[model samples]
Target chain A: MINYWIAGIYPRNAKLIESTRLYDKTLKEQFKKEKSRLLKIQSDNKLDFISDPLIDWDDNLRPFTNSLRGIERGPLTRYYENNTFYRQPIIKSKIGTSGNILKNSICFDLFNKKSKVKIDILDPFTFYDLSANEFYKSEEEAVNAFAGIIKKELISIKNNVKLIQFNAPSLARVVERDRLNMVKKAIENIVRGIDTKTCLNLWGSDISNTFEEFQEFPTDIIGIDFTSTRVDRFDKIKMKKGLACGLIDAKNTKMEKSADVIRELRNIKNVFNPESISITSSWDFEFIPESFADRKLQIMKQIKEKSKMMKL
Target chain B: MKKFPLATQEIGSIRKPRWLVKLLQDKNVSDEVKEEARSDVALLNLKLFEDIGLDVIYDGEARRVEMYEYSIRRIEGLQLAGKIRSWDNKYYNKGRCTKKVKYTGPYHVDEFLFVKENANRMIKLPITGAYTLADWSYNEAYKSKEDFTIDLARKVIRPLIKDLVKTGADFIQIDEPAATTHPDEMQLVVDSFNESIKGINAKFGIHICYSEDYSNMYPEVLEMKNHQYELEFANRDSWNKGINHSNRNGYESFLKTFREYGEKKEIGLGVLDVHVDEIESPELVRDRILYAVKMTDNPNLVHVNPDCGLRTRSRETSFAKLKNMVIGTEMAKKKLQL
Candidate 1:
């Protein structure tokens, strides 16, 4: 059986975006109004595992930069091939994440008592790769320090969410064999005692053929960004666990055809019998305008409904 | 100041006056009335630049709205789609190239001529390039990027450059922030740039804001049809206002390459960081210019400018930054005995 869910930060509606620019204090009522609108959309789709759309986040790294004790936002680094930019996290001193950074960023008021959620954060290796490390003596130490914060944060929210997604965009590249082991070890330490389902999401480049490297990661799911990986070569690829099929195009404004999305789902179902499958985006929805992103979400709903009827 | 080695100049745009912005946005205002207001502001802006002692100047771009949208609205076969995010809170209306793009100039001619009418210094007119327009737009009309860029270079932008030359525009700068965005598109940029200036007889420059990687543009960038390469440096450098080696570290990475080209290509060195409202001190600007002059090994080729644009800053901040830039350049000139 499979489910549909959205991952990462979402775009602010036009009115909210306008208000954010002018208002020093966030319009809480209006903010909640827009967030509830997003929540209603997800609830209408009948998915147990849900996301908040993370409207408060400027980028995936922003909220954490403020929460963490030793890091600050640096220059505008280009976010992959897209025209958008994200502030680089500069790890100035030894990192200490005291509070629940992820939990603070999430809007729980919009969710009902029964609503389960999915939490997204950068994995240890990916966080290090994205950051400008000034204090860490070695890559191993930095990865471990980051893994410590992830463990602490996950412990706080493990009861509320259905799954924990560790976004590792750096793994989308051709990593050295030794570095892959380091990421695997880091994830192992981060999720050592946590019983919640955890997935490692990778994107920004094609690592389809290199799926062999991820075989040892101690994760419940291995998410692949299908937009970067060739879908035609799905026959040759193999998967051991759940596959979060990132079919939605994050960069392009053109909406995806539901039939095309279903065809790829069918292709994956035939090739590998994974434990679970989820429909998601290749990257954050922040790249697209709010108007288009909302329309795309509706199209994704259609794809999920059609796939279920066809017994995907 | 007779032979200013590090000649100060304006890059991109200055902050638009609040009154000008309000007048333009007011729906009840007539187009004719808005035009009159903009021209009046342009003259005031020109005087502002002159007061700051900029050797080369423009009208601070008060007459146009944004660099892209202003041109996109006038050109044929392009429709202005609503706002698209350039950065946080800053939106530019990104248009889609729905058909073959055509040049319906004098898009920038009136804007440039008005500044020329008011300016008392050498004018280096900044116009958006063909490759940038092609790259930035949604390419639904053209067969491929190459085709769209070539048509843009040859058909659209080339005609405008020819017109600018005829109108006594001395130095024409083609602003291509998207030049090295995609490394594979480097040669195409070179080809399209040469096509834009194929037979035009005028001094030209290329502006690339915070290039992803300058190494990729390489020898390919040198082949382009331009005289100056105006790029960002101060954004990446240290904020420390000192003449020490580490203070000017950001510009160190590209100096050897600029030195290799030597006086054959001029370096429009950006000494002020426009993103920050904190005005750079004269000492900081002097150190940056001094460092580049020594590193590039040719004082004659370096021209001082802001890293990108001061348009993002407030009017007061832009004025202070420019004022300090001129003061800093003079201080460096005095030290160099030029």
Candidate 2:
């Protein structure tokens, strides 16, 4: 039977917003309060395994650019897409990570208590491609520079981390095979000698365009956005690493039927029955309202039960 | 007899009054009562425009909720299914089309007619463009984004434009803020726009602003049926303090595009910045307009306006900005000796 771990990229849903109770408190206070509440909710859910709650009450609005703003040399702008705006980190100078990059952002309150926790970070290529490169000479150099900085940060926290998923939607956008090679090099640099299981989550575009390049990634697990990408063609490819099949549409409020989700999972299991398989939303639940996200998770739990009954 | 050297107008929408906003927010107010209040507010906005002495004016969109939602709510074959983030801490109640899009009725016609009857001057009707209406919403039922966008143009936008034209609206501005979001699909945008305004007989224009990928806008955009391009240049004037376009990096590229291809089209130069709270000095607005005139190389084709809508700011800010815009246009007219 498949392990059937349920996970998500980020947990900043609308329900979290309504329940967080942020009135007059500073962003720091809100972050801590929201973090505690998120951990409690996740603990209550009692899933098999979980990822970081991304209790970014402080940095959720600007996530990547907020990290850069703390540093001396980060120029940022609004990233407009999907009815949401993220701060596009504009590289105005040599990129460097401040010690306070993810300090107050991460919630370790539920650490080592109930389930193994995963931390998600922006992939080196995504970090490079999404930004305005003023300092770096070339795209490759900027990616590598970003990779080196991220590598140092990961190496320090690799012991406690069960898995480190790199959000690499930018890789999916690349049409050229040569640029994919540069992304591969950058990924290899970031994960060099790390013990933690590395997962690469790609969304916002079809992954099949860069499937050949994705196969070359050094990560231990790969996530496919089955909602957006035609996972029907995926059976032909002989897969090796664990696969996280995104069966839920994160952007839509309507919940997928549990049986339909299970059927999709079964198709993926038949194709690349690798080390294990996990079910997840196509992207961040933040794209959806809280009630819908909660309903979607409920459907995921139902799908897990159905999958177990099928004994695939 | 002529007002100023170049025509001065608002892109669309003025700042909504706070008391009216409070009344709208009150759930106890009946829909009938709320609509009556909104009509009163619309009349107030129309009077305000005439008082400001704008060459072309709108009802400030006082009766509608922003641009996109108002249309979505009225259009058939659409449903508000989810909430999506528009920007930092701001989310729009978004929807999608599950069936073939059809015309529900004339959503903007009543609003347009009300303004037309009230305004003493020429009034332009601003409708959310087909591309933006489709682009901003999720595509649930459409076979392809291109097909869906075309459907929107033919079924939704074209009818609205025709109705507005039939109602004697002299100018109709299609707001396509999402046009350049996907640079690859700009061809689709242009094609769909042509389809929307296909048989509509009115002076049509396109309004685009705050798009991050404005640089990716291909020269082919000017090929649309629009006679004028109303864009926001003042919003991009963040780094500069004195309101001069010399410091704006965007101004140079925009100038190059207009000078190369804007000979046939009128350029509504946004001389006053709307994003900032600081009211621009008339001299600054004059300088920005003068700079835009010099860059475009066709002062006759250039017009003066604010960068974008003033709906987000206070009512006083909106009026003051328009006042400064008028004063500055007069200053530029003197300098140009027209």
Candidate 3:
């Protein structure tokens, strides 16, 4: 089986852009309308799972930052290598979840109540690494506490959510190989009792050497950026879990050919046979413009249709 | 050159007057109305900075919409895709260069000449730097980052700068907020900045704002062709009143690192935290200044200013910050009895 969905905040259209800037009464109206429009766009294109554009989120870290008990929104920090910026989550005291962490994140009022929803959260290690840890005593303890926080967050949203995606752009930046096991343990802790499917998406770094370590992880799907990591990097590893191949470059305005994407995916499927194959974006479409992001979605749909013809 | 021990200058921008902002944003307003409004605001801003006892000031960049768009819109061969958020809901119109970009005209020259005509104090022309232009834009045409930045310097920025210098604009402040964005590309910044002022005989200083650690630029930044480097320090430091190493901890890396290089370049020490409206007391600003001076062992090498542009703050708040900055510098000077 093959699945398709997006991972991060989609680029805002003209209406959403204006409404967000104004931040008036029209903000909620525009947001609800925009969410429906995005879900419809994906539904019409035949994506296996659908999600809100995350228009309400300032970034992926907002939900946790806003809902967590002991975290404060700190000064603006660069979001990875991109031009985008986000407030660093400052840990002030012992971590605790106060309310529904997904209250602001997932909106059921816009959904059909039957949509296979996909939610993206910063992976525990990446969250721990990106955060300013003033309270935690050790790296292991902080990461475990973060994992517990994510587990609690997932447990609340598990009943309706179809896929819980953990985006780990900083996962491959772990220099010490021993930390890889720690990350694996964190991943296991999040999805331990949750019945829904999950994807552990890793990108922005070539995890060629650590490919073997991820093959045994608890995630049902392990996503990799084919651009950052050469397709042949995982040629030897016969993955136990399914694979999500990030074929589209999200940062640039340039369009990718669907035929080229299918050809690459075909080669990827031939060697490292997994339970299934899924196509995704390299990271967020937030870096690109709205018009270009829509065009990229069209290209993603074409790749899905063409993959059916190959029957690989 | 060091006659003024602690000179003060507005970094780049001041908040546009409310009525002027409205006039500029109005689609029905005539260009004559828009131009007159900007000129009036510019005149008032010059008086405000001067009234605060600033030794050097500009027209507060009232004529241009911003540091980036005003320059980016004037360049040819680059098409603006759409608005993208930098922080909060603040948007910058991102552009893509499909071919070699050239300056459409010297838009800043007229603005510079106008400021010189109005302000009695020493003035600076704050233009966007080449590395920042290349870093902020999507460079599809240029072969490499170096090629893109160099082209922007030699083709776009240098020509406009030559025209400004001809208009009696001797003190040029090149605003490069994205200079140390990529720590590895510090050489590219030096190369492009050096290329921009190759033959021009003007006092060029680089103004770097909020970004990654400026410490990354050091060792490499020393090679850049410029006399002074103005940077933001108040954002990281506290507002407490003390000249000790602990109170002025924000400038610790800067003081320690620059001392290694012998503190040759004049350092623009930021005293006011522009992000907040709470003004730093004169004593606090004095401490921030005294600490930098004590570490450098030369009060002449230090210049005091706000952290970055005051474009986001209200006009009243911006004026207050500058006034306190002047008072604080005076306090520092009195203690030294210079």
Best by TM-score: 3
CAPRI-style docking class of model 2 based on DockQ: acceptable
lDDT of each: 0.81, 0.73, 0.83
**Candidate 1: tens digits of C-alpha lDDT, residues B116-203:** 8888998999998888887777676887889999998899899998998888887888888888788878999899989999998888
Q: Residue B189 of candidate 3: its Cα lDDT? A: 90
Q: Using lDDT as the measure, which candidate wins? A: 3
- Which ranges of candidate 3 are over 4 A from the true structure? A230-237, A267-275, B1-3
Among all windows of 10 consecutive residues in model 3 chain A, the one with the lowest summed lDDT is A98-107
TM-score of each: 0.94, 0.88, 0.94
In the predicted model 1, the residue pairs found to clash are: none
Q: What would the per-residue lDDT of candidate 1 be over residues A169-220, giving only the tens digit for each residue?
A: 8765746888888778889998899999988888777875677788568999
TM-score comparison, 1 vs 2, better candidate: 1
- DockQ numbers for every candidate? 0.39, 0.38, 0.54
Q: Rank the candidates by DockQ, best first.
A: 3, 1, 2
lDDT pick, better of 2 and 3 = 3
lDDT of 3 by residue, A106-224 (tens): 77667776678888888899998888898999888899989988888788878778888889998866656678898888888888889899888988888878878877678899899
What class would a CAPRI assessor give candidate 3's docking?
medium
List residue ranges in candidate 2 displaced over 4 A. Answer: A1-48, A55-64, A67-80, A110-112, A155-157, A176-178, A232-235, A269-273, B1-5, B30-33, B219-222, B241-246, B281-284
